[model samples]
Target: MKLKNQHIEEFLQSGLLDRYVIGDTSDTENTMVEDMINQHSEVQLAYDKLQEELFLYANTNAITPPDYLKEQVLNKVTPRKELEPEYSKHENWLSIAAVIVALLALSGLGYLYQQNTGLKQEIVETTTQFENLERDYELNDTQKRILEMRLAFIEAGDTEKYLMRGYIEEEPLRVIAYYNQPAGKAQIEIAALPELEKGLDYQLWADVDGEMVSLAVLNDLKPKTISAEILKKASDLNITIEKAGGSKHASVENLVSSIPLNTIP
Candidate 1:
């Protein structure tokens, strides 16, 4: 029994267990290995261990073959020769079935990969739409705040509107002013004003006690604001064209327009 046990251990380590699990053993060798598995506990355990390892390897390394390769593999598969009566038909059937199931699983993996890729694209598109909606919401919120402020200014009791026109009729310059005397605040609208030549800008002045005080230097034609205490005592508003940036003192000869605030009442 000791010698027989040694033979069995030697057989287990001879790499026959690997060949048997992958269906590479001959009919005679197959019979011998099965008899050893039924008769010896060690042989059976080694065979079972080989089967488990093979299954784990197949699961870990399986891949989806391309369509043409799938057809080629199917065409290459042929039935094995009929073994003698002593060979187990049940074992052959299990091997063939395992092959079929593995092929089907590889095809299923291809489908699952496509589904995963499509889901990733949809996630990207949904993220872009959400970002665009957030930007639009922010723009609408800004416009809402601007409209509310404009409405408040219109409703104030001390607010006055003044229109100042250019002295030279051919130049055709104009501006509108919304002035609040109590708050000493004013908003100047220059939308109708002509575009300035290059290297020139419009400068505003408040005529206080015969002196022209600098209020603001205009860059673009956008609306301007004057929020100074000096506006409360100003008798008139003036605009003049100055060099780039502006001048320290108004060029009285270049006065474009002037409106008398004291005569407005």
Candidate 2:
């Protein structure tokens, strides 16, 4: 029911309306036109005008006769000598009308050709737009599903949250940890952490009992979410700036942030 001017114009320019009015279109086309006429006011108005014109033309009750009948009638009306001038005048005017009709036919063909090309181009453009929209919709749908999963994990009854405030940054920076004991999964969320300098690596470590265990390397921590495997005996978490790959043990002098995790579910 929602139609644009261009869409309506395509059908009108295709000469389908004339065919529908004269019962010349195929069954499918007739069905389409008839449906539009019922649903679309523009198509209905066009069909009505065409029907009016057809009716008026039929009701005129006068038409051009055959050439043989016209010749017989003209021959009876004039003398043989005077009729030459009349015939000459008739022939001249008839030739001009024929040329005009030919030109009109050629112009009509050209117009139809242009309309067909425009419609094809519009169809191609519309198809491309639809594909792009579908792709974007799929991408957004995937992101939405991921966010929903993260939400469910955070809201789970067996999840514990830990927030670590960094003292190294002038601006306030924080890291959030979500540990789910039942699922044995740990997720890290960095907030307001600036870009790391080249060659500097931020390594994460889990302090179990008194021994430090390597957990993950927090490289380029730019306020993004990351997941780490929770150590079975780890009681605390910490981050330290180390070499590019990471360090075997926690560098307490390079520590930026630390959090105790004894209350995790």
Candidate 3:
């Protein structure tokens, strides 16, 4: 199994298992974890143990003190004979100590409550920040990869580059394309685009002779590396506004721009 004792320890210590129990994991991960529990005896045992601990914690009674705690409290509250010993000379002192302990316990509980609330808020803020950082990192990494591919395509010395105009011009589109038909690769650099309305997106089409073939429908039009196969049979490239995903046929009336692919530079 990929999971081991260290994994269990981490889950137990880092509170991941608590998140899992509460359905905080993503759907993909939740499904995978359930599968592991079903497939692996070790995983099942660990998971069961966690569940049992939670069940005991939730159902345990509040009024009854444990024997050690009961003994400690009784020691403080019990009245001793006055002439017994110097140790037993505490008449009002034990009572005072008991009250002080109770007050301190209550104060500690309040302090802990405030601390827990503060920690929860910090956790939420940290989670959101982490998600944003992760997204930015992914976008930057993807852009870097696209740029590298574009450079390689250019260096290969066989390309048909086009300006495509209109800030890439697909009716709310923005892309700078490096198309290499021989290598079957297309690299696009996205600059800017008008914000798309809900349920609408920009689509790219390859115009082959007279037929328009659906190439790609872009919603998150990040710099992309696309297959050049679509361009191989294409004599022209066209961009248009389309429904969110794509259409079987091109929306020519909605065409924002067209670039001839084979024009000699």
Highest lDDT: give the candidate number: 1
Ranked by TM-score, top first: 1, 2, 3
TM-score of each: 0.55, 0.51, 0.47
Candidate achieving the largest TM-score: 1
Model 1: per-residue Cα lDDT over 1-265, one tens digit each: 9999889989988887667676667778877888888999988888788777766766665675678966655544544467554333546544644564565477577668889989999999999999999999999999899878866785688788878888444667777777887776788776566667799887888898999998888776777777546677789899998997999999999998888885443
- lDDT, candidate 2, 1-265, per-residue tens: 3457778888888998886665456667866887778877989999889777755644453344457755655554344464588555544433433333444455566668889999999999999999999999999999899889888988898878888777556766577788776786778777656456677777778887788787677764543443445454677888888887888877899888888876433
Q: Which model is ahead, 1 or 3, in terms of lDDT? A: 1
**Descending-lDDT candidate ranking:** 1, 2, 3
Mind giving the per-residue lDDT tens digits that candidate 3 earns over 1-265?
A: 3557676555456655554554456656656666766766767787778666644543342234357766676676666665566335433343444444454455567668879999999999999999999999999999899678667776677775665655433454455677776566786665666666788888878887799987777667566666687677778878788888888888898887788877432
lDDT value for candidate 2? 0.71
- Which structure is stronger by TM-score: 1 or 3? 1
Local error of candidate 2 at 67, Å? 38
In order, what lDDT does every prediction score? Answer: 0.76, 0.71, 0.67
Candidate 3 deviant stretches above 4 angstroms: 1-146, 154-156, 167-174, 195-199, 263-265
Q: Cα deviation in Å at residue 124, candidate 3?
A: 16
* Cα RMSD for candidates in order: 15.2, 17.7, 25.1
